[model samples]
Target: MTDKSKKVTENSDFIITLNSLTRFVLGAVGGYNMQTKLKGVREMNDGSIFNSSHTLEIEKDLLLFFNTWVDIQGDKFSNDRKGFQLVTTLIQALGLVFHHIWHCCSNMSKTERTHQIYIAAKKLAQINYSRDAEHWKNCSFLTLNEDDLNYKVNSGGSTTRKHFARYLCSKIGFNY
Candidate 1:
């Protein structure tokens, strides 16, 4: 049987690359809607608190999508009601980041997607790490990369913004 005509036996074979799957999910015209949603997420007191159920739904979706790949054990913080709340809050923060990424390149052509992702990466880096424009522009995006969920959080389950930012960026294929 020819490679092109062979029937796939595994579900994993259906997805050749994460970017391709992401591209399919973020279809043409998805950017505008994502942008509007991002504005809403941003307006929700920086996604630390979710008031709308619609936003909550999207946040849940984001968590499912993300955790399906790399399980972010919120229990890493602690094991109790407070840990549960911590997990939910962390999911909300990451959902905002996912929305921001989709909003950046969802409507762009393949040729322009890298540039858009780069811009998004730079902006994210600025938000979480450095404010210097030239520094990020010249630095490697991989510099932001780290282990999936093992980050330095204080006793209260709080961490720097860069931790989540880098994980999402790395998983989303931000390499330079």
Candidate 2:
């Protein structure tokens, strides 16, 4: 294989390794229970403290994963294309995960989790818009269009501002 391809493969392997380690750590730290609670929120509108606890646990895991990845790859990348691609992929994964968490939280009965989700979403949107308004200028991934906005207003949770922020964070590599 070519040198660049080899490098990409190596980087990808490293990322996979890191992902596995993070999952392991999360599992050890009661991530499974958190995941179950998140699933429960999605399946049922039960707004319990379990949901809040799960959200907090997942959030902590996300922060740790990002910090660890950055620490390992920060100096090694140095503007390299492969490194940039890796970082971007990681960010996208993070945003997607956060969006899913938000969705789960939103599913809960109007309670603290729901409120937290709304607040988090708003924060994410603000951060994205502030960092680069242009990134969302022409994007239509999540009902950014006028029609979509009107539709969402009519149907709640169809498209959330928080999910949009998560997407922007993923795209722009915002260290949230």
Candidate 3:
């Protein structure tokens, strides 16, 4: 079968690449409604957060659809600006999606496995590790072998905002 026909497997590197591309794409559409909604989140003095769950659901759907569309197109647009833009949009959507997913995981009670996944996703987001670094720092952890959950917590913030995206896929079954 052609590579395009085969399913894309889940992996940290791919997700990170997608996230970076997404962030770049967001730059092109800075005033987008979704972007505005994400940036408009408000926290009140009484500790109540005012945000739209409807918007979050829209973001989630967009992310899923964009990623799936990319998979459907495969490498056909790989060598052009459209390809770059598409990838960027897909990645940026991924970062937003995961950002929200982490929040959802945080607010809900979960199974031990899911909770552990959430913790890793949190640390991964905190460290801002590149996918390679994320792989080095937490691949094993992601696989359930770590004794210390806070391992990536103390790392520098120079890491890219890609780990949560990766974690969403590898740990939480976010198929592209």
Candidate 4:
């Protein structure tokens, strides 16, 4: 085979190995419930559990995996930039999955919401390295700023909103 073909085969093998390792880790972590649900989806026509309430445990594990993967990818960047990008994209995809899960769980019980939020915060703490932390922090900062502004406007406090916006902009290094 050509050199390019060999590289492709090697990459595929690496991905398979990584996937096997992930499954093993998840299994060891007591992921039987998730595995069963996934198996149900594949084996039954109406077995999909798309709602968050029904898949809370699985979502929690997925969240944990995504956060851990991002940290690992950040470390890998020191050795390989392209590989880092691929892993980073995978992390982003996980975040998207979490967003969907959150939407599905929105109407769930308060206890469930609290549990998911706690999991999210814990996972976020793992993102302490530079690349991952920067992205996550910026997203959080923007979200907070938007929420603050909305709250101020809804509460009928233009002056306070302006002051808060100014403070946030300055803190974020925004000129003018």
Q: Write the residue-wise lDDT of candidate 3 on 2-110 in tens digits.
A: 2222112232123224334434233212212233233454443245564454345335434443455344444542323222222333345344444454444555554
TM-scores, one per candidate:
0.28, 0.24, 0.24, 0.22
Model-by-model lDDT, in order?
0.35, 0.38, 0.37, 0.35
Evaluated with TM-score, which candidate comes out highest?
Answer: 1
Candidate 1 per-residue C-alpha lDDT over 8-102 given as tens digits, one digit per residue, 9 for 90 to 100: 12332331233323322322113213222422332232334334453443444443445432333333322332221133223333444555664
Error of 2 at 17 (Å): 33
What are the C-alpha RMSDs, in order, of all predicted structures? Answer: 15.8, 16.4, 16.7, 18.1
**TM-score quality measure for candidate 2:** 0.24
Query: Which is better, 1 or 2, measured by TM-score?
Result: 1
lDDT winner, 2 or 4: 2
CA lDDT of 87 in candidate 1? 33
Give the range of the ten consecutive residues with the poorest summed lDDT in model 4: 149-158
Best model per lDDT: 2
Residue clash pairs of candidate 4: none
Candidate 4 lDDT by residue in tens digits, 45-82: 24553343544545555555445544554554234332
lDDT per residue (tens digit) for residues 1-176 in model 2:
12223123433434334433333333323323332222223322343443245546456535544454445444443334332223323334334445455455555664565455444444443332221234544445423336433211112221332344345445544432
